[model samples]
Target: MTGRLKDKVVLITGAASGIGEHTARLFASEGALVVISDINAAAGERLARELGMHFIAADVSKEEEVERAVSSTVGWHGRLDCMVNNAGMVGVVGSILETGAEDWRRTLSVLLDSVFFGIKHAGRQMRELGGGGVILSLSSLAGLVGGVGPQVYSVAKAGVIALTRGAASELSAYGIRVNAVAPGLVMTPLVEEVYGGHDAALRGGAAKSPLGSAAMPQEIAASLCYLASDEARHVSAHTLVIDSGVSAAGAGAAPQFHHQPADFLGRLPEQYQ
Candidate 1:
């Protein structure tokens, strides 16, 4: 039987791992001709082979690489319908004061400029298709608020949300839809590395969640499917937060340090709790 994306052509960056890998598999399973772009040639080729999709070793942060990847997909598939800007780097876990200039540039280049390149090149291709295309970005809760670790990552993500809004407003005139997905702490390989590859760290991330767990890559991939499908045709310039309510209450993995009231003990002692 045919699928929702049968005959559609989708291009996804950072397609070698994490959300991008899952998204590529999901899109191909749904019958779309997938173009997987990533700097990791081996993983990209493996996934493309496994999923029967096209693979391109291109760095999304570079304009020439981004252009070549997008052009290659359009040239190979005849038309481009969906673009997923999922290429990004996880910066060092440090405060803004500790973050070096080079690290900051790398973080912004990977997380922010990559998306900008995707939108610019993909926008051109989708416009050629007369619009009716979708551009989905993988932003984070950091995009909306600031918190623990990686100041550069946070700032870069914030830029993604702003980019989403700006592109959506202008691209709508051309019939192209632009949106973003802000994933909470998901249990991807990236997070595993963040946890020092310890199962306990994964468990800690899960335990910290308001939902008692973080999401799986598949969960985020499904959201990507919905966003790319025609069902979300009217949805533009919006961020679908898949953060398990962490962004809402600031619940997961964050410190809570509020002093208990000492009204009753106020009369008893000055140093009492």
Candidate 2:
């Protein structure tokens, strides 16, 4: 009854709630010696205790904190097998004109700079350990298209994808695999809060997808597990899209197209339907 990540030393940032929390639980269930890192000390400690994993209270945006997180994990486990840079926030919600410089910088620091820090430290650890490790990042469907999210948030996520590609290219030389997951509308706690409630969030999320449903946090977590596991040994520098076909349909594109009967074309007014 060996698990997919048996004995693997995995660290997940923002492991206190939502997708990060779910991923921590799933990784532990799969036999990883999970280490949970988050800015929420109380929730992170509680979850670590619940799952018998180590907890590190570190804001992923801080390079020093991020470096320490990786170092601490490696110190405890003797090697770092995987690092999931899942910490993020729905940055200031507004148009480009409405977004201030502070909001933009903070959003990028969390969503983009944090990944860079994680890759920098984790990549070094893996290389020092004699090669081989996985780095998974949380991108979004908004990163792939415009008008789906706040300007700052979208820009940050798009930067994550580009970072993933660039890091993967360089890290491959050291047996490290870098990849990202772009989820569409996942009904996490933050999302529910924004939409007012679970029902509203689900309804809104499902409306944007071709599947008629929003993704659960667990669904996105599952994708993380796959990327972290040995099954993805050959897969690198790839951003897996787990949007339930939303991206394929161009996010919010009309699901149905109108068709006119052959005889009805001329009956319609010019420039009108």
Candidate 3:
């Protein structure tokens, strides 16, 4: 209710749940005319009703649907102020050896291609409106390093980073800012399911980082809000990392200290050992 984004028009993909859902709610509270887009019609409609925002059922992987969603938002609000390309999936879980072409393509389509579509269409609308807009995509710590996620998922996220930078370079003249948020371990319902339950997911996430905790959806949402609001008017082409120091520590560097044995330093000098 701070009104940081007052009167702004925002569209969030995959906003039926997780980080997208949280960001949509946060944006709405701050006075943005929010549009919730997701393939989950049931949840999307329910959330739209709850927040008094419009809901569009669009599978972001398809260019046509993404185009329609953006057009619909602009048609309703007369301009698109912000586009959050937040839809994502873990995709095939195995290494490249076990991954199929279909799975790889699907992952890229959802995670990478969708961002391009959003930026392209939103940028067009913003150019027409003559007011600068912002584009934010959800990236991952896995994109910046290895072994943090499945190979294909990491690859798609890496593409998002590159897309953000390239688009920012080209779109800055029109007053549009392109950026991304690279989150490490976030405790959402999707992650809870993957870890078998909420408690287990929290424990697992906490064990991996220097902060001894994982980020909540709200934490990531706050970063999204800042990037979308006027407070970040000068920010562009940046991938804000909100990973509880996990990425800085190189993903689980803290755990290495816990796994060492008392005699692990046997080769060291006697006094040091």
RMSD of each: 10.7, 11.0, 10.4
Every model's TM-score: 0.89, 0.91, 0.91
The weakest ten consecutive residues by lDDT in model 2 span: 254-263
lDDT score of residue 43 within candidate 3: 97
Ranking, TM-score, top scorer first? 3, 2, 1
Model 2 residue runs over 4 Å out of place are 253-273
Q: Which residue pairs in candidate 3 collide?
A: none
> What does candidate 1's lDDT look like per residue over 1-273, in tens digits?
248788789999999998999999888888888999988888899999998889998866678999899999999988889999998766544545555576567567778998999999889888877856999999988677666335666788889999999999989888999999998777787777657775865796777677887688899999999999988889999999887777777753332111222122123112111
| Candidate 3 C-alpha RMSD relative to the actual structure | 10.4
> Which of the two, 1 or 3, has more lDDT?
3
State candidate 2's TM-score: 0.91
Instruction: Output the better candidate (1/2) by lDDT.
Output: 2
Task: Kindly indicate the candidate among 1 and 3 with the higher TM-score.
Answer: 3
Q: Best lDDT goes to which candidate?
A: 3
| Regions of model 3 farther than 4 Å from truth | 252-273
Model 2 gets an lDDT of 0.86
